[model samples]
Target chain A: MYPWIWRHLPGPLPVRILEAVVLVAGVVALLMFVVFPWAEPKLPFNNVTTPQ
Target chain B: MDPPTEVIAPVDDYDDEYEDYDDEYYEDDDYYDDEDEQPAPPPDSTARKTVRTIGELLITAGLVILLFVVYEVYVTDLISAGKQDDATQALDDQWSSNTVATDPQREVKYDLLDGQAFAKMYIPVFGPDYKFSVVEGTTDKDLEIGPGHYKGTALPGEPGNFSVAGHRVGKGAPFNDLDLLNSCDAIVVETQTQWFVYRVLPMAGEAAGWAEKQANPKCAKVSPLGAPYDKTVGQEIVLPTQGEVISQVPHFTGEVPAAQQAALMTLTTCHPRFSDRQRLIVHAVLTMSYPKAPDFVPEEMKES
Candidate 1:
């Protein structure tokens, strides 16, 4: 479904942007949910005050 | 490894034969068999090869973790707390000295606009022995006891830009909370002689050395009650003109409307704590301004 959407969207330019957004979001969500929390306090720059 | 069984058997047979043959037979056979049994225990296991490699990896990991923890917990807090303590100790020592303790002296006197302010800032939160002179209307260099008055600016009492600078961490971070100052908090400037009260008025970026220009605009004759001010306009009250200056760091410098000129007491410190990419500015106003009363005076400075 995603590949189809990437190939044909309402606008050619906007579709590329949309595709980029999806890629970035995937990376961020992966880091936050899978990589980061698992790393716990050991994560880089996680020492100081963190978001409650 | 144990000797072959055949070799040990022969040696044992020889001994038995000697025992049966008697002393004469032993004397005839001149060969001596005095070797100790139970060969020296095999050298300790050669396991260090693996252990060394593992040890190195653990050490590296431990170092990295330790550095991260220290930076997070101690570096920032220690710097701030140490600085505060130093400032406080400096004040306490000043008061405890025989000069201050023996006399009834009032170094700081009262005033409304520029009379009563922070006569001096003593950060007790820094450390036990850390202290620096806070000259009335002087830069960090003038203090001459470590922190100095900033070069090329007005003294706290005179006007213009009553600029001061101190460390954010190390050498007793006197201005660590500089970033946290809100739009209107109290910034009192008191001196051993008198007090000069002022309000905070941060400048916009591009206006100039805004951080170094925190002073009482009321004393400078710039009016918060004067004509309506347009921040974009190049207006002058008493601060030095922003020369053709370029900074390695970025700063905010918008002008304060004439009406808001007397609304703040600005303070600034290096931004992000560890990086000098920008400055953390806090704008505080004068809340309470009064002289150190005779009773409040340090005895050392009092007249005999």
Candidate 2:
């Protein structure tokens, strides 16, 4: 999986490294802001309030 | 493949890469390196490729769930702390702009807009830095900003319960340490005008010392309840369905008896941290309320 990602990141050594960082950061941001918050209500994990 | 001088690939061009390793390993084997020593089996064998695919699939699944856990415990806290700070800052701005209304004679009405910060709660025992913005609603969205006040419950210093709900494990975890509070620890609430100081009631097995506990300087002003409320303790665990814990008299019904309706504050959070199967509730009774004064800090309000 990691090698696949490494392979897809285009450019020379320095440029590929920078792109990989950007790609990882983008994934983290998406999970943090959109995916996780959207999934919060659907998941039963952090149900703090009463069922009312 | 080349002059022995160029045996190693430049490490730059991708073509001559593992192609050489393949040739070197399999040049001799037909089945094994010792047998035909054939060219490194095309890139990778079907078996090796399948194994890699399965391994990657499991790793991807594991990482996604791990990321979700990280979002729940750490990411959400980061997001919500920023939100809580904003709410607190807005409330501070509003409070600072208010003209003095220090009249003990007249009644003061606290009208809190939905989702707005209406009060600030502090657990003196939790230390001076333990304050949280008390917003007006208990919905998840509202709580993401700070501890939320349960709607329809009493407001601060009122006659019934001023119930609040906060996350126990994440989203700022305003009540993460709630269980640590023992009998008679003061929980102070600051509104526009008054500082309502409350003290935790006796815990289940500690009620026998209610009188002795009240003798503490911090508890001196916190009076015990009568009848319907005499049994309510400082801490309890109730199922998520027990909404009655926020009633005018927790776990009790009937029109509130004027004498029995003690002004109380209830803090509810998910119990057994990181899980929400039950609720851990902390109940405190109003001990005293004084008009806000610049130099007047409550004795129970300690930094640490």
Provide per-model DockQ scores. 0.01, 0.47
DockQ of 1: 0.01
Estimate, for each residue in B86-138, the C-alpha lDDT of model 1 and write its tens digit.
55465545544525423456343322121112236432223333334443222
- What are the iRMS values of all candidates? 16.8, 1.9
For candidate 1, the per-residue lDDT at B92 reads 49
Clashes of 2: 13
True-vs-predicted CA distance for residue B254, candidate 1, Å: 17
Model 2 earns a TM-score of 0.83
Q: Write the per-residue lDDT of candidate 2 for residues A1-52, one digit (tens) a residue.
A: 6788899888899999999999889988887788878988787756677643
Reference A-B contact fraction recovered by candidate 1: 0.00
User: Which 10 consecutive residues of model 2 chain B have the lowest summed lDDT?
Assistant: B30-39
Question: Which one is best on TM-score?
Answer: 2
> Who wins the lDDT comparison?
2
In candidate 2, stretches whose alpha carbon ends up further than 4 angstroms from where it belongs are: B1-39, B42-48, B100-106, B222-224
Q: Write the per-residue lDDT of candidate 2 for residues B1-304, one digit (tens) a residue.
A: 4665475445545567678878876755645645454454567778988899899989977987899888888888898899988998988888777655566666766668777897998888787788899998888899888899888889999899989999887788888888899878889999988899888887888766668776677667655566788668889999999988888898886787656588988989988887778899999999888888888987769724
